[model samples]
Target: MIIKIAEIEEEVVFSGIICADRFKSDYENVDFFGPVEYSLKIGRSDKRLSVKGHVQCSLNLLCARCLESFRYEIDSDIDLQLLPREMAPTDIDLELERDELDVRYYDQDEIDLTELIEEEVILNIPMRAICKEDCKGLCEKCGGNKNLNECKCESGRDTRMAQLLRSYLEEEGDGHGGSQEKAIKVKKG
Candidate 1:
């Protein structure tokens, strides 16, 4: 949905439901099977356009641990300042002020709500998603999903430590020459 700045007089309030399917191409990795309800108030103060809104949606995300798909709901608050390209500073080396973090520059007179919604949805997703707090994840050895089924692979020793111990025991005559010879003979026997 594109909001034309020219259409607005001084201030306007808009509220509608945007189909989540519209953002399917934007978020190819995740699935959105719900509508995004949004209510925004756009007002112009001098050359700056202030936008405040609320967006809510549901998403189907894959659990990072068990690799199972689950539904997750998102409700995000939108507070932004839209500045014209000419008013924005051109210096890339300059540090941004604290308030400038939420400021977005617009090259054209229209603002694309689709891009904004996509960004908010992606940002709201957790860094690491798990189906449950006690999710048992997959078995490293047998590649079995531990949450669903148990595996026979040994789970006590760390794989890295076991590899190191095996490498040390297989080394030929590393200081304990006689002990190494006896160990090799016992293995063959």
Candidate 2:
């Protein structure tokens, strides 16, 4: 991901990088691994500097249903101006803003873009991972892994009436099944 200063002449550079999922920060939510690609273009024109490029890559994720790994690829683009590190225009008695496309410095002259790519990829990851688009998740009873085994753990309540009653109350408040008002009605009726 390092580009030498002398190479910016209207030519594009293509390269590959190993995107460690951990580097994505948020990527640790789901275990994953894989490769990333980047294409960069850099050049300068008087007081104006240009940094235009894009990145593309894929990542492996664990399927929530089967708990297996799968690949998900995505792409991103970048077009930006190169600004001065932290010097002021007034200090130089110049008309430009204190933080403009730097008549003085450039990014490649200092900062590296490795961190930028890692950030974009993590943001692009899918919120949910399914081995197959329509995978049947695990069975909640008998501790069975639905993708691998079958169990007689009644797909129904399979619990004592008292336990089911407690669970019903808990789930009702969870805002998924029905509201707490419905739970009170059920208890009374």
Candidate 3:
């Protein structure tokens, strides 16, 4: 939905649900259960626009580690300032002030609420989706979901440090005929 700047007298309030299918093309991996819901109050002060609202949705996602399907909830607060696209800096390397972090740009006469809603939903998605905090994930050897069932494969220990220590012990033994046990005790002390 596009909000025309000319139509706003002072402020406009909108609340509605956006269908999940609307985002299917861009986010194929994520399955939206409930439609995206929003409640926004967009106020205009001359040419400047301030948007304050809330956006929420339920997303069906696969856990990154175990690959199990899980439902994730997204609840985000929207507080942004919108300015004309012309106000955006032409220099790519230009630094932005702290207050400008929440600023967005709209084209000539309109603001695309649909695009803004999509961006909010996308931003709420977690970088790493985990079903649980202590999820064991998949077993490497058996290729089984460790959260569901424990595998019988031997626990693999990282041996790089052990290998380096062994090499060091061999070098010391060659130089001074020192016992491996004595060298280990000296190194520990």
Best-fitting candidate, measured by TM-score? 3
**For residues 64-182, what per-residue lDDT tens digits would candidate 2 score against the true structure?**
55665666555666566555554324555463553353233445454355765665555555555455534445666555666666676754655698557855654443353222112
Error of 1 at 109 (Å): 2.4
Q: Which stretches of candidate 1 lie over 4 Å from their true place?
A: 92-95, 98-100, 126-128, 155-189
Q: What is the TM-score of each candidate against the true structure?
A: 0.70, 0.49, 0.76
In Å, residue 183's CA in model 1 sits off its true spot by 57
| Candidates, ranked, lDDT | 3, 1, 2
Q: Name the runs in model 3 displaced over 4 angstroms.
A: 90-95, 155-189
TM-score of model number 2: 0.49
Model 3, 9-84: lDDT tens digits are: 7899989999989787776468888799999999999888999998988877777668888887777789998988
Clashing pairs in 2: none
- Summed over model 3, clashes come to 0
Cα RMSD to the true fold for all candidates? 15.7, 12.4, 14.7
> Which candidate should be chosen as best, given lDDT against the real structure?
3
